[model samples]
Structure formats: C-alpha cells, structure tokens
Target: MLQDTTSSAPLRSLLFHLSDVELLTRSARQIVEEEAPPCYTLLIFTNGTGRLYIDNQPFLFSPDHCYLLSPGTSLQIENGTDTVVCFYRITFTVIQARDQQQVLYTEDIFPNRYELRVYPLSRLIRLTEQLYAGRLGKGDMEWFKQHLHFQELIGFLLEHNLHSDPSLSLTQSVENTIHYLNHNFMDSITVKQLVQLANVPHWQYTSIFQELTGKKPLDYLTELRINRSKEWLAISNAPLRDIAHRVGFADEYYFNRRFRQTTGVTPRQYAISMRQRVLVKDWTGHEVHIPLQPLRIIYYGETIGDLVTLGIHPIGGNIPNPENRLYKDPTTIIHDVGFPFNTERASALEPDLIIFANSDERQYEQISKIAPTITYNSWATLEERMHILGDWFGKKREAEQWLVHHHNKTKTMWQQLQSSINAGETASVFTYDHGERLFVMGVTGFSTALYHPLGFRPVSKIQDILDAGQGYKEIQESSLPQYAGDRIFMLLPENKISRRAAEDMMNSTLWQSLPAVQSGHVYMAEEAKWNFGDAFTRDKLLEMLPELLQGF
Candidate 1:
C-alpha cells in the first residue's frame, strides 16, 4: 500500500471513500465485537487497557494503539476492568481508479495489519474530529469533502505512526524485565540488573517498575522468592535453609525476617498454621485449607452483592459496572481486583484468602499461589451460597438470621402482590443487546428471581432451558411469542441499537398480538439495574416488586 502511494500517484489516483465513523464506549466487563464488512476498519482506542483480538490474533490495547483491520477480519475488544474504554471506529472502502466499475478492491491492502501508535495523539484526534463532523452530512459535495478529509486523516496516521514514543520504548524494556524476573526469580538477581534491563536511570526505573508491579524491583523479586518458598514449605519436607537457598536467598536468617515481615508470622509459625487450617472442599471439588477467621480477603465473582449484603466487605474485589444499583453502595470499600482476576494485583494486596468464583482450573492454578484460593459457585441459589459462606466464615448464625429475615420480608411483599397476580400466570424476560441481538432469559439474571417458588412460573420452554443449564438463549424476532409467557419483561439495554430493536419489536404486529402485551401485563425494566439475582438484588426487589407491579 505504501509502495502504491510513494510511486508517484496523484490525488484522484488513490482515492479511498469514507463510509462511516462511529464512536463507542464499553463499560467494565463489556465486550464489543463484530464480523467485518466489505471495508477496511480503523479502530482508534482513545484510552484504557483492553484485550483486543482480530480473528484470534491477540494484542494488548492501551491508550496509544490503533488497529487497522482488513475487510472480513473479525474484531473483538474486551474491557476487563472498571475503566471504561472509549474508541472510534472508522469504516471505509478502498477504491482503485483503474478497476472495473471502480468498486471496492477485494485484495487485502498493505498495512491492513496496522497496530500502530501516533505520538501526540491530538494531531490524529483533530483530523478524526473533522471526519466525524461530516458524518451527518449527505449529498455528492459532502461525499467529496469527506473523501478528501479521510485522505488527510489517513495521511496523518501514516506520518505520525512512523515515530514511536520514547516512553513506550522504555516501558517495553520494563515489561521485558518483569517477564524475565517472573521466570528467573530462583536465580540470584539484583535491582541493578533489572534496572539495567529497563535501560533507564535508577529512580526512573524504580518508578516504572513500581507503577507496573506495585512493588520496587527488589521487593517484587523478594515476593516471588517468598511465594515460591511458601509452596515448597506446604508440600515438601524441606529444611528452612535449603528452601531459602533454592528460592535465591543467600542467608536463611534474612529469608526468615522477610517472610515474617511479609506474612506477619515467622516461617515456623506459617508452616504450623498451614497444618492447622480448616480444610474444606470448594465448589469445583478442590480441597483447600483456609485460615481461621481469615481477613484481608480478595473476592472475584459476580455475586459480590451477596458479600455486601452479609456485611462482609473484602479487602479487594471488582465492582463491576457502576450502573448496577445493588452493588453501587457508597460505603463499599473493596479495591478493584479486576475482572478475569488480576493475580499479580491480588498478590500485591497480600490477601490471606482468595474467593475465586469461576470453575476454570487453569486460572485457579495461577491464583492459588497468591493465597489459599477457593473456587465458588456464583450461580448457586442465595440460601445455599449463604450457608456455604457461613460455614467458611463461621457466621452460621448471621447467615441463618439474614435468610430468615429475607424470607419473611419476601413473603410479606408476595402477599401484597397476591391480590394482583393471577393464579398459574407465567413470566418471561427478553433483552436486546450486542448490537440488536435478542435473547431470552433462562437460568440467569432476574430469571432467577422470577422463577422462585413464590414468584411467577416459568414458561415450559424456559424451564427446559433452565434444566439444560443455559443462562440465556438467542432467538430470532419471529420466535418471541413461542418463548414469551403471560407476563412479559422487556429488559431495556443501554445501547441505542438494542433500544431501537426493542422499540421495533414492541411496534410489531406479533408483539401487539401477544397475550401479555394485549392484557397490559407487559413490563419494562432497566437491564443494568434489574438484571441480576444476587442477595442484594433480591433484597432490593423486595422494595422494587411492589412498585413495578403497582397497577398489575
């Protein structure tokens, strides 16, 4: 592509038509992906570190990177933390002046694999603003103007991308040192050696290393040694001096002191506690020994609202998308551990216990080294989960009391609604998201609440899905009534495309003819606020249900 441009092509000879420009923002734990159309797509990540994949080729997306995807290349960006990712997508067709009908060129363009950074991004942003400024305009003159602006924008991207940021180069060196330290930690290593690898001054290297790992170079190395020693101590009958020497310690006494400082216990005491811990089986059938009265907990799961409701605030956990009303407590003090479990960050927190809530054994293998980790079932019913937690935390009395209180409150709320609800009436939930794709709830979200014994009965198809262990199932618009029931819940998504899809469905003859729609049993709810069934959410529903069905 560069050869074509530099080979002496004039302005009209290499014209590329700009088809669309759209800005998108992804919230925490959200994924935005799509199959490519017959145009090249430029993805400009304005900010945040997201995981990016183009046709399964993964790349780290930070504030500096922009990706150029070829036609029919799949694109996926997963924002795995609390930071919102904002980006611009530019889709355009390449026009070859000498082609038949001058249509889009089918061959892959050069630099179609562009994953580049334009330092001083304001220059690119200004040119992009010009392109977006003209997106709403129409007609041949506007098209011609947009085409020229697109050329200018593409030119600026090419020019600035040739130069790489010096800080980025330095950071790459720091990351390389980190990767080295992670693998070579058993060998004798020093802060000076790591700093040399970073190729920066001592102070600057320390700052960058700490910024990335939340610890100084020497401290991080020591942590690796100590964590490794802990594994040996737990599983092997190794002598303290031998363990110290194997983990890169020249002196066992110094290792003892460092371990004591890091763990608030001597090496001997730690070994003893490991033997004395309460052994229990985790959700995924792993036997783990947990510390008695353990504090400084790190929780990774969707049922954080359960922890909040039980008055047990973990030292670290992820607060997924702030829009969740149940988990939006101003007093919640859990540090964001990141979704997908940022194990390094969790290790830095010095957690005594880690409550991981996924069944991925590979992820479990990594996190278990951070602390005594257990895999939990976030999908378990509230009472069962609470009882399990009560057993683990020695809060059986509190758990039972909370459950009894919840039962009485929900019973009262259901009695109030008994006069309004029809006997044997069923309910079904549907939502549109992921760019107008529609789904029917089965075992997840408020379906968990609506299928409660005291709540609405699930339609037969939905029950079948629940028995089959599906959270939700996607279906075409024509199949809505087949899965919908006497009471319908239309969960409004945050995105405009899905909102429009929901609107189109509500206006359709099929939707209008549904029994729920005709009998005024159709309800609208915010997907963000009501699409969960954790203890906190279920408790919130005690207050919300009456209002939602006030006139039912």
Candidate 2:
C-alpha cells in the first residue's frame, strides 16, 4: 500500500516505466493509498464493482465508471466483486500541461460542466491508452500529443454540456418596447409608459431593459428625439414653430426653450450662422453695374466681416428714409479690416479705416497701422452703438431719428407692462445646464437685456451677487442667490450631464425650499435663443418676459 505524503511537503515525482501489466494495477492501488504526489490520477474500472473514497467519503463506481481525482484530495478504493477488478490507472503530476493555454480548457469551454456527466469508463480507457502510448513512445511529440488529447476531451464535454436557454417571450417584449419608442419618440413618454408597453412591472422591466441593452429606457428615448431634431434643424428650412410642433412640442415657445437648452443656440440662429460660415452664393441677377471703387470699412472679427461682405446691400446706408431710397448704381467694393479688430487675422486684412463698436482701445492698436480705427466701447448699449454706426457711415442724423422712433416705441411697451405689474413684484435671471447647475445672470449679462431695458430691477441680493462679479463663472462654481424673488428665469444646458444636473437641482430639497421653487416661480428659458445673443434671441426674450413675469 502507498503511504500518505506529509501535508506540508511539496509534491515530488519519480519516472518509472510500466514493465508489467499486472504490476500496473498493483502500483495504482499503492499510489491511491499513499496520495503522495497530491496530483490527478485517472482511474478506469472495466470490470467488477469498485468504490473510491475521497476525504473518507465513499463514491461508488461500477465497471463502466471512471473517476478523476483532484490534486490534494485523499482517496481509497475498495473492490466488492469476487473476481479481480480489471482497471487502468494513470498517475501524473500536473506540472503545467502544454494544452492549458488553449481555448479547449478555458473557463467557457463548458457552459454547464458542473451539472453534466463527463469521463465515462469507455472514454477514460481510450484517453488513458492514448496517454500511455504517447508517454511510452519516443516517436510522438509531447506538444502535439497534449494538444490532440485536450482538444478531443474538451470537444466531447462541450458537445454534451453546452446548450442555450433564452425565453422567447422576454425577447419579444423587449423588441416591442424598442419599436414603440422609435415610432413615437416625439410624443411625451414616461417610465410608466415604457413599463406598460413592455407589459412588465416597472422594477422588473427596468432591470430587464438595462440587462438587455445597457441603458435606461427614457434616456435612450430622449437621445432619439434630440438626434432627430438636430437633423431637421440642419437640413430643413421649415419655420421653427412648425418644426417644434412636428417634433411634439405643444407650443413653439416651449420647443424653442428646450432646443436652446439642449443645443446652446436657437434652431434658426444655429442654421443661419453655421450656414453663413460655409455658404457662398453665386452672384446672380443683373449686376447693378456700379463703378466698383475700393471703399474702406473696418468690422469685427474675420468671419463676422466676411459674412457681412457677403450680405452687404449697396443701396442702403445712414441715409434718411434709406428703406425707401433705392440706388440704381452699385457702390464700391467694401473692404473689411477683419473682425474683433485686434487679432493677427485682422492685422493681415489691413484697411484704410477701421470700424469697430463695443470693443476697447486695445483692439484698435492692431488696425492703427492701416488707418485710424474708430473705437466704440459703448456699442453694447444698443442706443449708443446704433448712433455710432450711423455716424461712422455718414448717416448719424438719420440713425438718431430711427433711434428716437424705436426708443419711444420700446419705452411705451415697457410703460404698458409696468402699469400692469403688481407693486413689489420681483424678478431674477438664472441659467441652467444639462448637468442641472444653475447660473445667475446679472442685470448686465445678455440674459437680462429685455427686463433691464424695460425699467425692471432684479431683486437686491441678485443684483449684489451680479455686481460682485460672482455670477459669470461656470455653473459648478456659482451659487444660486438666496433671494427667491417673484420670478426666476433659468437657462438650461445642451448636454446630457448638464441637463441631469439641472434636473437633480430642481428636485433637491435645497431648491424646493427656495421661495421661487415653493411658489412655482421658476421659468426655463429656451436654450437655443439664450445662446445666440442675437436679434432673434432678444426678440424672444422681449416677447416671453411679460407673460412670464405676469404669472409671478
């Protein structure tokens, strides 16, 4: 009988040739008894009853049965049959088999190997014969033999063990949900709606949805709408209001608000501005053959001046009644000094005279080389800028009259709204991003242009924060003013993170506790319009403010 090896000792092996067939069985029994090497022993029982005991637990084996004993496990065998048990045994040290790195023995080799039967007596006998023949002969290469044996063994096991089990009903349910969302994405959809469509409880459906496709259902739907909207915005010339309605927004205002919130500019502005940068229209129609003299004029930024050159009308200037005054002769080719005035690009596009409004003297120095560049720092003050432009173009007198007319018209509109505003009513301007971060815009920021011009004052604390230069930072760094005010205007972010952050803030206890939140005075501005900072954006705010403020 083989004696037991010490538990603490490392395994050792001795190479011995199989000389006698009868002695092989006897040696196997000794090896089983000793459990000395603490390695695998392949045993095949061809006749008579046999039993293998592991860790003192008996596992009965028949003539057709085979047992693979794991290393480090103790085993004892007993033969109950009167006839000598005919068996074949192989004891090998598992010192890094060559086929170990092959896919044949990888973790996924058997899908459910633990529950399946493998290594029957007949199969084990064949494998042992192959192993014995390969080991005993010098003709067979060790690597090839190992590879063939391992491949055959894995193939046999996998063919019997690996089977797929997927529920058809579950797959169909997911398909239906995806189809419904794709067909009706523009319509307002909620989690509850998806759960209903999937015909599963909300909690169960959420898990299945994520497990199947790795995204929340609503998030996926929102992305679809946003993507589709982008395509329509870029290629289609439909009115924004029509596009908004077609995309399932109940009103153009809300659609504009959401589009801007998502894309940072209004749909019209994004289309027009981006198109202007790349679009070069062929000169068509009868060229009003005017003597094309080089006219010196400076404008802001390279692209801005370039765009203006493309659209400049020769018939209009600061001339009084210019809208009615038509010039039969085309004027000189207008020369641009370049935009933003101070850039290297502007320096390259040298001009005889520089025309810039609302920029500082620093911007004027670069163009001073070409000619005396006029600086108009107060251009941001709409009235002042209009006058400056009018004067520079030899239409100062005409521009003053136009300014007076529009100023009166705007003032009247402001007075009308003010007359209706309830006493002590307050307002605040704030912007939000997709990440849910709120930015408080001061009275001076472009956001407050509509309200501030109309004699509406921001709440004291809001103004103080704005005055302290605290509101212009990115949303994460800025804080929401404590004053609740009667009304709050918020600009939203275009990206998903900013949107989620803004939504999180809206649902937070801190936000709910604020007076605006409590009174439902919060209003979201159209993101597209908010981003443009153009005439259309200004017009939208003007139209929206009175109604929004009235509710507060």
Candidate 3:
C-alpha cells in the first residue's frame, strides 16, 4: 500500500501499479503556465477559485467546486482572485495496444454538472497513501487484483458523472415523503391529507408514486403503525391501549388484530418473546436466568440515564420513575465520570459489562479492564451509532432485519400516498427549538438515515449546503429566502427561552418574507418525540408527511 507522507492521519494506499504520483499546492502568485500530463489527476479546491481551459473550453473551479482531469485533454490554468489550488497527480501504465498507443483506463467522459463525486476521490486518496508506504509487491496475481480495482474506480466515476439519471429527482421526492411520514406518524393522518400536503393532484401523484415505490398509501400507513407498535411493545411497558392510540390506531382491539395479522403474534406475546431473547440462557438447558441474577451491566459518563431509559423500559425492566433515580441511585452507578479521559470510578464498578454513553477513549480503556466495554463515538451519525450498539449487544442480525421490515413498510405507505396526489410536488420537515433556531433537518447528520431512506430531496440550496459539508449548521437569517420550497416543516423550540428566541426569529422581517411562510405551507412540529433520531423519531417523520404535503 502507498502512503501520503504529507498528511498527518494514516491513509491506506492504492493497490494499483502507479509509475508516478505528485501532490501540489499553488497560490495565486504562482504562474499557471503548465498543462497536466495525459494521466489521472484529482484537483481539490479548499479555499480558492480558478479557471481551466480544457480542450479549449474555459471552465471554473472554486473552494465550492472540484474536478477530475482525464488523459489526452489539452489544459491551461488561470488563477482567480486570492485563489489556491491543491491537486494530486498519478501516472500509471495500462496494457499496451497492438498499434503501440498507450491504453487509457476508461472511455467514460466527465459530466458537466457541479455535483463532484467525492467517493472516488476519497478512495483515491486512501490508495495513494497505501502506495506511498512501499507496500505494493511485484507478483502476477497482485498486479491482476490492482488492475481490477483500477477498472472499478474508473467505472464508478463514469456511472456517477457521465451517465446521468433523471429518475433520481423523483426518487428523492418519494424519499423525502417517507422521511416526513416516519418522523410524524404519531399524529392522525391519511392519504387525502398527504395529497393536500404535497400540493399535487391526486391521480398523477398516485401513478408515479406507485410506479417508483410499489405500494398503496393506506397499506404503507398500516405497516408503519404496526412496526411502531412493535417497537413500543419491545421497549415500553406502556399499556397496549395507550400505545395503539399514540400510533393512530383508534381502537385497541383493531390495533391488536392488525398487529397480530402483520407480525403473526399478539403484542404481549411479541414483547415477552423479545424479553426472553435478551435474558441470559444456561448452556445445557433452555432455562432462563432469574430476575435477581439478571445480567449486571454498569453505565458510565453523561447520558447513562438516557440509555437506561431507552434500554430497560423496552426490555421489561421496571423501576418506577427511573428519572428520579438519578438522584436516589448510588453515586457509583450514575456519577459524572467525565468523558474521553476519566476511568477510575468506571473501572471500580467491577461489572460484567460496561457502556460508556459518551465518546471517551481513555474511559473506554479503563472500563475494558473491569469487563467487556462498548464506547459510543459521538462524531458518527445516529444510524452509525445504532449499528454500533447492535453489534455490541450481539443483535446486529435482528437489528438489520427490523430496519428492513420498517423500510418496506414505509416504502409501501409512501407509494400509496403518492398514488393519491400529483407528481413533482415537494415537502419539508419543520421543528422549533428553545433558541428559536427554526432548525430544518436535511439529508445528513442526525436526519440522514431517516431522510435518505424515505427518498426526500432537500430543497435545492439546502441540498447544496449539505453537499458542501454544511449539514447541521445554523441557517442564516438572510439566507432564508433560498430555502423557500413547495413544503415547509416548522419545528418549535421546547424550552421557554428557546421558544421565545424562535418566535423572535420567525417574526424577523427576513423570515416572514419567505414564500413558504406567506403561502401557509409551514406545519409546526411540536411533539417531543419528533425532536431526536431513534425508532420513535423515524415514526414521527413518516406520520407528519401526509399532513405537511397535503394539497399539491
């Protein structure tokens, strides 16, 4: 594997047989006189802009944009104001042709669109580092493997860039609807309500939606309800009647019958079975351990209370008013065992297992001594964390299966809703915070798993920001105009101060002038469950879509 010695972080090198590689950074003062060789080059623009005359056509590049250059293309670079260009160049041999001409890697031409495919670039960077490390060996089989990887890299870039698919836009809209429905499903909603919210006509919406997604609206909704019921049953000790009502099932008997029809078991039976699976089983027999001998696990750092609430309640562990236990429980059990470094108290807990709710490596090492420990990394997105947790508890297979089941259910419901509305309509997810930030969840960060799976496209500018690695950043008051779209999800802040701040922000001259606000397309997401990313969060996003996208 080659290594990029210039970089501080360890990067995996490319497995390909590259003859030469160079990484260069040039400022505006430097003369842009040279043309790139007939080889592959990746140009990353971090804090500057420039223009290149490629095949005699002038094209722009900037910090907000990047480009990949191909062989046999004539090029000339011209610097922009205060511009800087950072680029990587790679020279590699392809199998020679009979005519003695050097064979190129792939014949695919780059697209004209600005959506730079970052995945390939990321891979290339890794591969380059590996190559720099002097790990590439000389062998026939190794050479053949490298050739295959190179071919794959070329193919990926071609498909992502040159061969464009317009269907992605429609698919994105459907996804958006799914995301909305998942997050807001607790409310009373219907297909008619969805058609109205989406602002599309009924017939056109239905056909395209079904064509793309493959299910009717009502069926999807019922599936979502059933799936939500499953989560509630597994995680919460709340009465079945209350759970049914919360999920929009009007009658308990109807909810029970539907749940059984979908899952092949009564809610209580399903809950009990899940609990049984979690209990420690003896090796010789299938006998379950007694409650007094339950698996002894200790939690460390902040958010221990949150995790306990999430885990125990659904698993049939009852401690009436566990929130108050934060005060009454042993300080050893729920201490402020600071994160990323603290480990003394956690190690002394001396339990079978430990969970560090916070992402702290030092604490992780300390707890590892006492027992098997799982430390969650906060930098990862919510879905990433869920997958980690699933693996930690030996439930990856079950978790994946559950995800697939809910995904299918949401897909069916989205298709049904679309069948009842017009095509080309749009929607948004809205929530208000205590700071009155008017946070709009987009297609990355906490909302990526929910939104991407559902097929929603962020409004153009918002999508652009997300693409630029600006997902989860604060939306500027002046930039609100660019986000006006066919639908709006208005989230209100939870606390009084946050609410006041949100009200002030909304009342601002700039915010009130937006098209969405004027047209009454905004729907306030005030539910507490809708605020976070979890199974419940997925439900709320779906439920709200029908209401948010109702009339197009």
Candidate 4:
C-alpha cells in the first residue's frame, strides 16, 4: 500500500533548510530567474496571468494555480499582459530524510516532475508572510513549530495531487469530488451527490477519497463545515440556528451535537466563551488567549490609526510626536510608549492587552511577560490588515461599513477631481528618509491608497517600480524628473538628516524644473501620516486628498 506520508507515522530525524521565499511582483514583458544551485521550488500565482517555462516545457499559469518543480529545475516566466503579475516562490531543501520506509518512500514525490495543481492562495499567503517576516523566532521550539507549519503546507499540496499519478482516472475523479465539496460546503451535501459528481460508484468514490485525503468523503465534508462554523462563531454575533444553516447544517440541534463531537464544546458554550475571552492566532501562528473586549490595551506597532478607527483607544501606544499633528480632533488620552517602546513604562500603564508588529519581534518575549501580546504583519495590504483587526476585535461589520464609506467618498472625490485633472494624469510619491536618501514610495502607506482602483494612476517608471515589488526606491535628486509624474506628494521626514536633505533639495535647480513643480502640483505631506497605511491614516488621506488634488 502507498500510504499517505503526511499521516502520523514518525521516526528518525527529518532535517530541512529553507533557502528563500518571496512574493515577487512583476510587470515587465520578460522576467527570467536563474539559480546556481539545484533545489526544489514551489510557485503560487496570486495575481495576473503569465506563461512559465520549467526547463523547456511551457505551462500557462494564472491566479490560484500552483506549480511544483523538482531539483535542478529552471524557471523562465514571461508576463506579456499589461497588468502586473504577482506570484510567490519558495525554495527549500530536505537535508536529512527520515530513514523509515514511509518517509523514504516519498523522497521521489516530484521526481522529474513539473506539476501544476490547484491550491488556494489565502492559506499559503499568510504562512509565506509569516516566514518572510521572521515572526516565528529562531529558537529551537519556534523552529519545530515552523517545521510543523511547513509540513501542514506540504500536506495541503499533496492532498490536492502533488504526488498523484496523472494516468489514474480515479485520482482525477476523487480530486474533482474534493473540489466540489470545498466549493459547495455551504449547501446540503451527501454521499450520493459527491459520488455522482465523481462519476463513480459510491463505494469506489469513498475508497479513493480516503486513500487520497485520508478522510472519508462525508467525513471531509463535515470537517469543512465545522471549520468554517468556527470562524463565524468567533467573529460574528449570529444566532446558533442562523450560523448552523450558514454552514449547511439542516438543524441547529444537529449542528450543536456535531460541533460538540468535533470540538468538545457546544455551539452556545463556544460563543459565550469567545465573548469573554478568545484564543487568537496571530501572524506568528501562536494561539494566545486574550480578552474579547479588552478595557485597557497598548500597542507598540504602527497601527495606532487602525486601533483608533475601531473606537477602542489604547491607554498607551507608539504614537509619534511629530512636529505637525497630522490628524486633529484628538480626544483619546494616550501615554507614549517611547521610541522602540519603553517596556518598563508600558508595564506601568497597567494594560491588560499588548499588541506589536511582527517586524518588531525582538521585544515580544519581554513585553509578553507584562501582558498578553499579539503581533500582526504591519507590512501586509491595507485591506488585509484591516480585515484581520476587525476579526480579532469582532468588529467585521464596522470594518465593512468603514470600507463602504471610504469607497463612496473616494468615488465622489475622483469624480470631482476630474474637472481639474485629466483622466490619464499620473501621480508620484517621494519621501526624504535621511541625508542623501530619497525614496519613491510604492504599494505601501499612502501610496497604496492613492493608487487604488479608480484613483490616480502612477507614472510608468513608478508603476514598474511598484510591479517589481520594491516598497520604496532610493533615487538621486537629479533623477527626480524621471520618476516624478503630473502630480507629486513629497513627504518631509522628521529628522536632522531629512531636514538637511530637504534643504539641499529645496536649493537644487533640479527640483524646481520638474513638470509637477512648474505646474504647482507638488505638495508637502506630513511624514508620519503619509507613511502609514492604517485605518486612521486612510481616513485622514480621504479627508485631505480632495484638497491636495484641487485646482489640478
């Protein structure tokens, strides 16, 4: 029997080393990647469409499609489309394979193979972000946990046909059935329906599905419904019956019984417990028990704007003391946690909950000792982070409402600005980081929101920079005209070095000759407010953007 390697049958050491992983964004017509060393590679396309060549074999790839290549494989991806293509690549090696037969048997899983499969990017994207950000520490315990996460990822791929034989008709049939179940889990599903979809006998369909996924077809459907129900239970105030029906259960009583059987807790108990305190899994993948409605909270992260938007004012946070207060109408009494955050002072605030960015991981342990701490990826997209915060705070409705309002406001403002600004007019954002370090912002902070759908378009050069996934490009003052667009928003960083650079730029003839400058389309932006992509910052941008875009 070819047993499923992902199943629990462990022995001996299985050492692994991760070479690199990244979410690459590209807009160039032709982009080629070459590596000196031969290793296993995995690619997941999340945006746009492109043709990828593994060696000489071409595979037409698009969003939600995944590719796995064996050792010594070479890749040449081409994006002929005008839209930007974004994909994630992960490279790693298995140094010491387990000596056991089960482990050794799966060693040649993708041998001489360039396999394309279907795997949802949502699950894999979060894991890739965690690994890329180093939120999982380098400690032995953390390493073990990271390895488990990798195993889970691999298991997901395998379940979808990473190791399945293409010649086997039953394999494809089982896969289709699984896909059907996944997409229609909210509808009443039965063995007869699944078997009909698989186009196979009831017994045969169940047998192959169990062999491939290690779960019976009906059992798999139940698990999917239960998992989705857990998400709704944590984030919504929906009643038990409504929640049960939402996840495909015919009755609330049956849903309660099945939920208890699977999770060892009833639906109502789970909801009540979560209402008091819930176990939150953050970007680090750590399940930390936190208060559902925290009274006193502090955060040592750049998402103060997001916290403020949620209407839960933090007792203390890493609020910047900028020379110019960007957003006025300040009502929350905030205790500054100091630069890099003063742990001792943070403790003095008597906060019951603490939040930090995954980037600021060094302070996690020390700060965690004072209060329960959770970390979020500060670098993720604005929508991604906002939805995550909304889920954690059980304010999804509020988040959705704010987004709707922002969308309406942005639409109206764009319509109004069209009178002065041409339809194809371009914009660019620049910031003075320090002495001689001039950065052109890409898809982050204010730049991201500014270049959103129906918003101003970026210049070709800046668009290429963004497509290449460069957060900010450092450029010389003399090169400003090349990157500057019809309109420019220049951020003034609050530092002596930046002050010196700003003085130098102000004195330069190169700065005065730019098209945007000649037309008086250049505006000064407060660094703190313009550089952050949080809800508060976004709202502030909404309030100020029309004024900035007025009169062309």
lDDT values, one for every candidate: 0.74, 0.46, 0.50, 0.69
Candidate 2 residues 1-552, lDDT tens each? Answer: 111121311112212222211113322123246453344445555443444665565444444344444445566766543323445555544332343341111121222111123445235444444444344223346446544664464345344334422232344355446655654677877889777655666787787777866888866665566555654665458887777766666777876777687778887886655332111111122112211121334444211211132232321112111111111111222222223233454444333334444344454455455544444442144454455445344456665665576557667767778765545667766656535456666533444454445555667766675566453434343245455467666655545576567666666777777787777667664342343332223433454455555632
Give the runs in model 1 whose Cα sits over 4 Å from its true position: 1-276, 327-331
Q: Candidate 3: minimum summed lDDT over ten consecutive residues — where?
A: 1-10
Could you estimate the TM-score for every candidate?
Answer: 0.51, 0.34, 0.36, 0.48
lDDT of model 3, residue 424: 50
Against the true structure, candidate 3 reaches a TM-score of 0.36
Best by TM-score: 1
Worst 10 residues of 4 by lDDT: 1-10
lDDT per residue for candidate 4 within 467-535, as digits (tens), equals 886678888877888899898887766566885687578558988888888888876655744677777
Count of backbone collisions within predicted model 1: 0
Superior candidate under TM-score, 1 versus 4: 1
Compared with the true structure, the alpha-carbon lDDT of candidate 1 equals 0.74
lDDT of 4 at 410: 74
Candidate 3 lDDT for residue 495 = 62
The segments of candidate 4 whose C-alpha lies over 4 angstroms from its true place after superposition are: 1-275, 322-331, 468-471
